[model samples]
Target: MNIIETSQLTKYYGKNRGIINVNLKITEGEVFGFIGPNGAGKSTTIRTLLNFIHPTSGIAKIFGMDCTKESESIKKEIGYLPAEINYYDDMTVSDLLEYSSKFYEGDFDARTKELCNIFEVEKNKKIEELSSGNKKKTALVQALLHRPKLLILDEPTNGLDPLMQQKFFEVLKNENKNGTTIFFSSHILSEVQKMCSKVAIIREGKILKIETIDNLRASNYKKVTVEFDSAEMADEYKAEGMTSKKTRGSQAYFLYRGPVEKLVASLYRVKIKNLNIQEPELEEIFMHYYAKEEE
Candidate 1:
């Protein structure tokens, strides 16, 4: 069963469009990445999914549970970490977690202690005393202690140190292996590429594309750059959909589908030193969507 599904899920704020016709589906036990540039409505879509705000039109379902009607029940089985977390500064870490546990009916003491130990969080310290990263970790502990079936994270690694971030990813990986569905939102392509199997690219409050990472790469999309032996051979190559072409001595660079036969054939006569194939960065691919979307 699809763990989450949305069809034309749209939302608006006053006259400002938040998201429009956002069609997204996340399969069970899969990590889906929500990618978009800043102010592109990533958070709005998430809020609509969580029913924190009602949609302007369209539908959303979490594990077949209606987003509008069953949000209370839906939240019980979902762990969510928003981009920003605020806490009562006077409360100790232990008190803060204990207080938040009242929302969900669960025995989180064991899990809470374990998480604190693993994350190296100080239980006795007041919330005001912790570093920004530590405070963020406290929020994470609350979100995960419920042991929900689905996890929704927005920019989860923002306040985390590199070491803690890696450790946290390991925890998420373990959760995924245990059959949890994860929907992670972030603009960091490298981490999304590493952690998510499927992804949706959104821009200007609209979803531009959704596909498996493998399928995206298999679209015969590549960047080909060739280096030539003779300085004069650089002029022989041509490119298609070629955004840029540069020549330096015998070395030439072009951005297009690889195995540039026409360009290579022209350079074959003089000196062909080496050829390099560079994969398009996710941001570049995302920009392609943006350009198409704008048009």
Candidate 2:
């Protein structure tokens, strides 16, 4: 079953635009990444799907129920973590999660305790007393405690430490392995590249690209830099149909989009003293996309 379906799903803020003509479908059990920079309308799209705000036009459906028409029902199966969170400051972490559990209609004690242990959150601390990372961890536990079918995580790793972030991803991966559909929004490109099987790159409220991880890997472009014995040997680093060269010190470097072996052979021809290979990160690829779009 399609876990989420949106067609021309548009949202506006008075005269301001949010997302326009967004058509997307998410399949069951897919760990999908919604990749974009800050203020590219990623949050706006998430809010519309959660029915926290109404769309100016178009439609959004989750589990076959229209977001605007049946948000109450659809929310029952959704586990959402907002990019920003605010709660009763006076409440203890234990009290806060316990209070939230009331809305999900289940005894979340076991899950809550287990999550607290895993996330290293102190249940005795007041919500206001906790650090940002701790508060974020609390929200994650609350979102998962209900065992919802779909996990809609918006900037879910916002306040985690490096160790905690790894732990959270591990937990999410396990969830996906067990049939939970994950639609995560993130500015962390490396995280998305590592975790998501499928990714959609959105910018200026438009989804510019969507592809499987394997496809993106295949499309990976490497920047091959070789330090030759002398600048006189720099020409040997050049390959057919390859352009864009930069020289610093004794190194002749150029970008490579073909097999790694070709670049290695070209370097060997130059009697390279040393070599460096840098792969284009998703952030680099995304910047290339937007930069070209503007042109």
Candidate 3:
């Protein structure tokens, strides 16, 4: 089942474009990644899906209900953590959480306590007195407290330290294990690579590509680095399908997407000191997409 779907979903802010012809279908129980740099419309797409903002054109549905028409009903099943959080300043963390809980019907005390303990949120502190990280923790706890079936997280780990980030990821993994559908949006490639099975890359308010992580890594792209015996050898060597190539002193680095034998044959004639070849990271693959767009 598609837990979330959008068709030609476009949004504009006055004369500026927000997202154009954006289409997505996220399946149930999948950790779907929405990735793009700032101003690429990641947030706009998310806000549209949540019906926090109305789309100028196109359709968006969550769990088979119209986003704009059925937003209040849909929101009951969604736990959202926005990139920027706003809470009543004078309210204590516990008080704010309690207030949030009232919107839904359930006994969330156990879940709320579990999330607070995991994130180390200070429940007694007023929203105004908490550090940025602490405030983020409190927001996280509030988001997860209701045990909603869908989690829409935008830059969810922004204020967390390394340890807390790891804890957060672990919690997300557990949530996914329990069949929660997660829509994770961020510019951080590494975290997306870690948590998502499939990702959609958006640029300039348009989706450039959507592919599974394994398929993307297995797309025959390899990160190759060679240390030649001399700078002349490094400068002179070139292989088929080499891109983003660079040479520094006696070392050359590039991405190769052709036959490995062809690359090895090209290297055989060169006096190479050392050679390293590995699968390209998600960031490298992501940059390749943008570079292609520019070209």
Ranking by TM-score: 2, 3, 1
Top candidate, metric TM-score: 2
- Tens digits of per-residue lDDT, candidate 1, 1-295, equal 9899999988989899899999998999999999888898999988988998999999999989999999999998999998988889889999989987888996888998888887888989999888889988988888888888999999999999999999899989988999999999998776787799998989889888887877765553556677776766677655545557788887777676544575456556556678886767756777776677679
Model 3: colliding residue pairs: none
- Per-model lDDT: 0.85, 0.85, 0.90
- Candidate 1 residues lying further than 4 Å off, grouped into runs, are 219-243, 247-283, 290-295
Whole-model lDDT, candidate 3?
Answer: 0.90
Relative to the true structure, candidate 3 reaches a TM of 0.85
What TM-score, over all chains together, does every model reach? Answer: 0.82, 0.88, 0.85
Root-mean-square deviation of candidate 2: 2.7
Candidate 1: residue pairs that collide: 229-271
Task: Give the winner by lDDT.
Answer: 3
The sequence of per-residue lDDT tens digits that candidate 3 reaches over residues 171-248 is 999999999999999988768888999999888899999989787656648889999999988888878799888999
